[model samples]
Target: MAERDGGLLLFLTGAGISAESGIPTFRGPEGYWRVGSVNYRPQELATFQAFSRMPDVVWGWYLYRRGVCRHASPNAAHLAIVRAEERLGDRFHLVTQNVDGLHLRAGSSLARTYAIHGMIDFFRCARECTAETYPIPDALPLDWAKDRLPTPEERARLRCPRCGADGRPHVLFFDEYYDEPRFHCESAQRKALEASALVVVGTTGLTNLPMRIGAIAAQRRIPVHVVDLEPNPFVEFAEVTGGEFLRGPAGSLVPELVERLVG
Candidate 1:
């Protein structure tokens, strides 16, 4: 699918890549939200159903998350990916499940990085009045306090830039399915199949599309590399396919791996 002389090197990253940057992986206590006396898990709170029922609660939760991501800086792994992009040029592709925008913040080209989970820095019309996403209003504080609802003025600013309708996070809600234009799901899958090498970093391969990509690549005997602090499905796949498994923190391992790849 790519015309690079050296073939494509595709990297699939997940929340684990941002953990070292001080962002919660959203698998533990940090993923829970309390509205009134009811507690909702990330899966429950991150759905359209929940948002439609209580838009204020949902916006507050997401705004708090955005604040967390905004304050956290990119770690070594993110920077290494940027360096990899610089050296490999068109031969490199980044498919990330993270919405923190750290890869782009670390200097990775936005054109080459496909954020399949969507970004936290932007919002789109909840009514789908427009397909374009607009930046979250600068007037809305990035340090949005937890459990605090938007003020009337802040709420007004959250309206769609084009139609004055309610705005939704640019993220893919749990209840929503992925599509080509919004999430780049199809493009990432195509790149996975075409990649000369598939590097699985920090992700457990629990999500459907990413799992499919790894399974197909392994089934085709592609060189699969797994880098993580512990064993997981990707590690098993790599070992079964006679691929490399580098066990350690992504912060250190990813940089070393990128250097070797670009050497």
Candidate 2:
């Protein structure tokens, strides 16, 4: 219900935004993690079955990823989103596919920022006894390259405080279905439905939710500006929605777009 010129603005981001901060994309070659002699792709390691089979292995992978994210700082693209939020205030809503938490770190409010992929810095009880998500301590090592499997001591430390059950990373695994309470899927859908303008940054629309967002905007005759390093499937959708496709790195293009739009 928040209005900007005549409509709301919804900004959707993906791994491309965080990649500017030197964070690797999940489907990229860098996303492959080796455990012992077996190499697991992100899709394989990031699943409920993987966690059920080897909780330590899964937790270790997440811990390593968390370390990487913690080491990387928010880039200009993230800061631009914060500025856009400031200008648009209640009219701006962010729906991000990245779990790196860069958007929140860049000062976007949690109330307006929907992390549809959940967050890497949070942990929940594996049993889902409660909906509580506890923040992981900052004191944990940021360099976990040596050990891909958590030590017995580390496993004990990762146990859920309330239920004495194993703690799992608060991320939407590949096999997990999206839900409102956990992943803000419903909220994102509602925002897209009501959005006056949709600004897509660093995403290729590979996932269902993002594609649906584009389709909704196109159907509603809302402008859908897309920014990415290379041409993507979204460019066609942008043209269909009467928006331009700005081909460039998000770090450079997003700030320029924000300045032009908000200035």
Instruction: Report lDDT per candidate.
Output: 0.86, 0.86
Worst 10 residues of 1 by lDDT: 1-10
lDDT (tens digit, per residue) of candidate 2 on 1-85: 2243656889999988898899988676777878888888888989999999988888888999888898899999999989989
> Once superposed on the true structure, which residue ranges of model 1 sit more than 4 Å away at CA?
1-5, 36-38
User: Looking at candidate 2, what is the lDDT of residue 97?
Assistant: 94
Where is model 2 poorest over a 10-residue stretch in terms of lDDT? Answer: 1-10
lDDT of 1 by residue, 68-185 (tens): 9999999999999898888888889999999998999999998999989899998889998866888898998998876677777877888997889999889998889988988898
Model 1 Cα displacement at 3 (Å)?
Answer: 13
